[model samples]
Target: MGKYEQLAKDIIKNVGGKENVLSLTHCVTRLRFQLKDEGKANTDVLKNMDGVVTVMQTAGQYQVVIGNHVPDVFKDVCEVAGISGGEGSGEKVKRKFSEAALDIISGIFMPSIGILCASGILKGVNIILDMAGLIPAASGLGQILAGAADAMFWFFPIILGFNAFKKLGGNPYLGMTLGAALCYPALQGVNLNVLGFNVNATYTSTMLPILVMSFIAVPMEKWLNKVVPDVVKTFVVPAVVLFVCVPVGFCLIGPAANEVGAIINNVIQGAYGFSPIVAGILLGFLWQLLVMVGCHVLVVLPMMMGLMAGEPQPLMAVVAFPSFVQTGAVFAIWLKSKNKKLKTIALPAWISGIFGVTEPAIYGVTLPNGKQFILTCVGAGVIGGLSVLLGVSQFTMGGMGVFALPAMIDPANGSGSIISAVIVAVAAIVIGFIIAFVTYKDKKEAVIENKEEKLVKGREVICSPLNGNVLPLSEAKDDAFAQGLLGNGVAIDPADGKVVSPVDGTVMTLFPTKHAIGLVSDNGAEILIHLGMDTVKLDGKYFEAHVKQGDKVKKGDVLVTCDVEAIKAEGYSMITPVIVTNTADYLDVVEMASGTVKAGDDIISCLN
Candidate 1:
């Protein structure tokens, strides 16, 4: 098979086929997919598949974590799915929903974070062991663990170089070669100095510059790989380019780039040094927003530098607030909401937040609705500002969260700073909760009154078409839906059954297996209900229908019915989804309480 053909097949198989995919997007480390049916995408199948390291469904996307070559994988997925790979607009999709995605984001960073903590503990142990004259610095287990722990930093360039190359859709090993050149032994010994002063140059554990360069290099590699002809190009072009490019990069590019990074770091440190309080507030509000854009990595480079330099960086002191505040804000929403589905997601987000992964809380909960995000930010900023002014500090480098408390206590500086940080964070949560509570008007009262007064015309909102659970559409696993790539609506927890309209509307279309149904509401809003994951395996056996395409459905109308228990027996979730396909056309899509909803129930109401 042709290389392109093989690549296409690999992407298709992991994504659950052309039909299962909703959309695809890419970031530094992942190819994010929003799928029509997440269950249809076989995790085990994808895991065992070649070129795949792990499949992570996080932040409401089925992320095929193909290690560093995720960009290539993403390109292949786009090719196979016949979709264009564009700088995706941050639009929201309405057809997908996910609980696992949120959980993964909130939890995925834990293992790495735990290892980081373990390494810190070991470093401290080594310090004590040496001070007490017990073991030498060359102790085997200690040295080995230290190396393992520090490897991510020591060789960040090489790792990211390989990753960036793959992401740009090129020869991954070639990318590694480029990274190796950056850290070459010959280059290490070379130096550029000014006025007899040794220029500070250490790439051993530096971040950002090399990785940034890799982004440029990977695309170059791909272009070179494709345009260069086979005959003498392989040996001649590569060898010549290596000889020329490596020197140019180190002699000219590397020094300038490294200096720029240093300048940025110094500027930030200077800002913090000027007024730690201001730094705390500014970073607390903006740090998460930067994280969303992937620019937060730039900020982190400086923090890593501070750890290496053994200095107190104000950013580190305030870093834990945003993560904690997101969890707090989400917890408040979960408690305030009557939605059982929200509770399920919020609970996991809360737990994950304690471990320092806030992606889930940020993407799945905070950003979806504008207000809560603002509240969380304000809360985090207030807390962070107070933390800095109060002289909070972290002695060790660790993930930011509850588990990170140990590292925050500097034995030399004492534990006062750690206590102050927690106090500030908790206070911020309380204030944020109050803000959120005040902002959340009694929508329930409005819903109850509308029902009692029959204000809901024949236009009663429909239940989710599928039967697993009702969830926020923003949390969909499919990218087309998660990033709002598709038009507005909500996602259903798909389970087998006849899909009913949530409102009095014309039937748009029913999918072949009766696994999905589409409708146009009286308001001209589009909606879809997709059934259980891979329940397609049933091949319409357990599916039943009362209406055909174009049939009219009133609120609470009997649209379809299936043996819910049988669907469960097949290992599918009974959770159902109710969607509003054209939510953008309206001012707001007011979802009903997020629990066991019934047909003809007011699933969502719209405002113009």
Candidate 2:
């Protein structure tokens, strides 16, 4: 089997098997799974497994922090375990506030982000054409492109309806139909012109009304599906549902919701008018946090509606700061990290950030590391607040990106809001650099533990048996290591003539070649110690052992020590692998007191 595949299986089993999982999802750097029963999970066991950064239960998902390679690991886990659905269940539903927030943010922004980015890029291209005089102000091409760009905003409900429906476990087509009723051409033409007053009742591109309509539609559809008789339920229920839902959705639901949505919008608009800087600071700092909870899209809808009405919404400008700030933060990390692997990841994250794709940056670099992410948010918020004071405004309906900046610029009004956007962008970048620079102390790099050193009772230590550069299991040369088959562990080599027990345990097995040993600790944890890098080539030769399979030993007991220099002279890396063969049962793995020593020192301390 491939390296990662084997490793995935080992980790999966360690986490209490596929049945233990209730649901599974992935962000840029983590595989978020919910367990069927947390009581049965050994998170600490999973955490110490090779290639894992940490394990957290938050926002209803069991998160495995595996960094940029999470998707690959997730896929491997699902395939091996025959997982069909996305979430794993525990005995009861448990809530994780942080994960819930993150999940919400992903839900709200991830769906339409690609569309907005594409539109922004196209808008930029159109601006270029206009600047170069290639497309006249009234050119058909310009109009067509502009119209294409506006289409998504105008019909955002239809798009959101599908996504929201999926999120809520309802049929998307029905949800879409419910949204279409609100913006239907005939319904939009219903205007009130009484007393010689022309008041537009247009609902095109409106956000709040359609969302309100969805709340009703989802429940109404669910009731209908449940109540309808078996045979004719499908046909009869849909027909009846459409007849009842469409009319109500338009007549009472859409308009009333529209009015309510407008009131909320008006309140925000008035507040912003009173203090743009305050609004910008609040919005910029909180926008990403809102995304984490899936409510950010709710904010986007109102802005889209303002765009549809051809009004320059201050909310648009307020949000632009965070989008740019995420990029700045990622760039700072990319420039600062000296690790080649981290540098490789940070580069792509930076590129994605430029296109206004912040998920990769947020998950891959920021959130995992903790401090850099907080700095990004605070630094960006400051820039946004300042931009508000500078009277920066953007007319564009799309989210932040260089392509959207020109659309924000208004030649007719000479608003100079686009310039404000530029200042904020530049300021945010500067702030991010300062924060990251100040925080960029090179922490300890990845290290593998060796098994041939001293061990004390009741102490935690890794017994790595091979020697080579400590590669992350995800990047290991061996298929078993790559797939996490060996558990939360690292590759190491025999540093001396003897291998010793890092914990008090019974020897489970001693391979015939004396190249590998398996032990079960008193705490019921299983460990494997494999000697030498690429020792499979030695076919277990030149290896000797003091202990046999099934012998009970205390911590620091002599197990096996090999000729390290001789092994190296024979062209094998003395790198070893110390692993918890079963890891998925716990909550996390914590590295104990550090500053390095020889073999058999405490390495990974488990937390349940």
Candidate 3:
């Protein structure tokens, strides 16, 4: 069996089974599923599953993010379920027209961002080589390599057309055909008289022209699909769709949309003229939100690409601020978190966010706490505004995060954007750290209780905190507990939500969310009882705490009472995890029993 075989099976089961999957496709990090019925799938179960990062619904598709190893997992998932893979079915669902357009644009362009950055890096490398005299720009070797790097951008219309057509549910061939006509060599610099008006347009390396033409090709292809018979559909569809779209494009949409680009550029420049600092701050502050709603790609990414066609794109410099801000906030969570669940998510999220992925941090850690999310914006905005005012510039289009620095390095002037970028990143981290530490205070009793618990010598046996069926920690749903990453533990599917003290101990810490508690036994066993996964979002509405930090209790003493049905009704699980948090302090933490248990029953045996 493959490593992810069970995860694949579980994911398929929760996503309404293999029968519910109409078709499946995967990008670098997510499983894009076109489901027969979106409502039938259990998003909560999928979100809490091990080996899954998070679940997102966007662009009329149910997306299950599987992180960097998604390709291999996608293959096993298809093979296990007898699925014929490739996403296409159920594409007719309607969304708001503007939102639909943004979805189509982002879906097509996001896949190419990796290659776009790679090619830009190569172009930057060539320029550096030429300037340093290590290689001659006029040489044939340099020319071939440079063309290799430059070709992806120069022919973007065709590349974008192929993906865009798939998104719009049109014949991709027809879309590519129209894109090719826009870049036909014979018409490269020609001005044509159409409809008693002269039109001059060339769209080889442009942004708007290709997008406008591709979207227009969508409805035109749909009309032709209905009229053209399947007997000769393959050739006839492409021929008719292109023949109509190409002429109409050059004569009408091209000229009109070309002027629209100029107008948008003018509007953007006018905004920047008022205060470049304010524009930078706004972009940095809202970039993550824009990405969440699927607008950043359509609005900001294209603008930078369009600007890069002629000269340096300064906007690219400010956009990099969000990556650092997001990572910094996660770093703060990692440093400040006492809840092992939060700590586990924070560490991995911080690592990925540094590399320019924010979904995990935003969905799993920061966004759950309103203050944490706002702090990221504050840090990003302050630094982003200062960067623009200091004249930080970028010479090419590329990736985000630390890798984006290559584009900012201008050998010609040595403007120190690289230094400023590093300083800004450090500032963002510091600001984020302060916000988390200040906003979420540590439990006051932890300091007082830890001093006494440390004086005890031997390990202590802990009893069950609830009347429930005992489950191995591996079955906890959440990876932080399931994988034993938060130390040795056991879990429960509680019959009732009454939580009691497992040992004669002091309550070391009580979460503000009222969903978790920490205790240290008199004999020195440090334990954590965490309620349902991600239940902290409830903010204590369904839970009533009978004890506070530093309160003393014996076995079977009720610590809290919760309305379990309220949690379940609100789409959260009722499985509870009981973990020996300070596992390193003992020789070994062992589970004493499994399968069935009652409150005060023996469950965890800690050895000194």
RMSD of each: 10.1, 8.6, 10.9
> Whole-model lDDT, candidate 2?
0.64
Pick by TM-score: which candidate is best?
A: 3
Clashing pairs in 3: none
Give each model a TM-score: 0.62, 0.65, 0.70
Candidate 3 lDDT score at position 231: 95
Over 1-608, each residue of candidate 1 has an lDDT whose tens digit, in order, gives 23335545656765667766655555544566666677777674454333453466544567664433455666766776676442122233454334433322222222233345665555545545544567655788657755765665555566655555443444556656766777665556556564454543556555455555555555555566677887766765556556755555555566677777667668877888898888889888887776564345446646755664455666876876787777777777777866444455466666666666666566545655667788788878887788788777766666556655555655464446667767866776676667666664322323345543324323334455434456776566443344332333455554445555567788776645675567787768777665654454566778887889889888667677778778888887544445565554555556654655544445566655
What TM-score does candidate 3 reach?
0.70
| Candidate 1 minimal-lDDT segment of 10 residues | 102-111
For 252-367, candidate 2 gives per-residue lDDT tens digits of 66667777867766876898889777777778788777645434555765666666556677667666667567777777777877644445556766776765556556655676
Best lDDT goes to which candidate? 3
Error of 2 at 288 (Å): 5.9
Ranking by TM-score: 3, 2, 1
The better candidate by lDDT, 2 or 3, is 3
Q: What's the lDDT for candidate 1?
A: 0.59
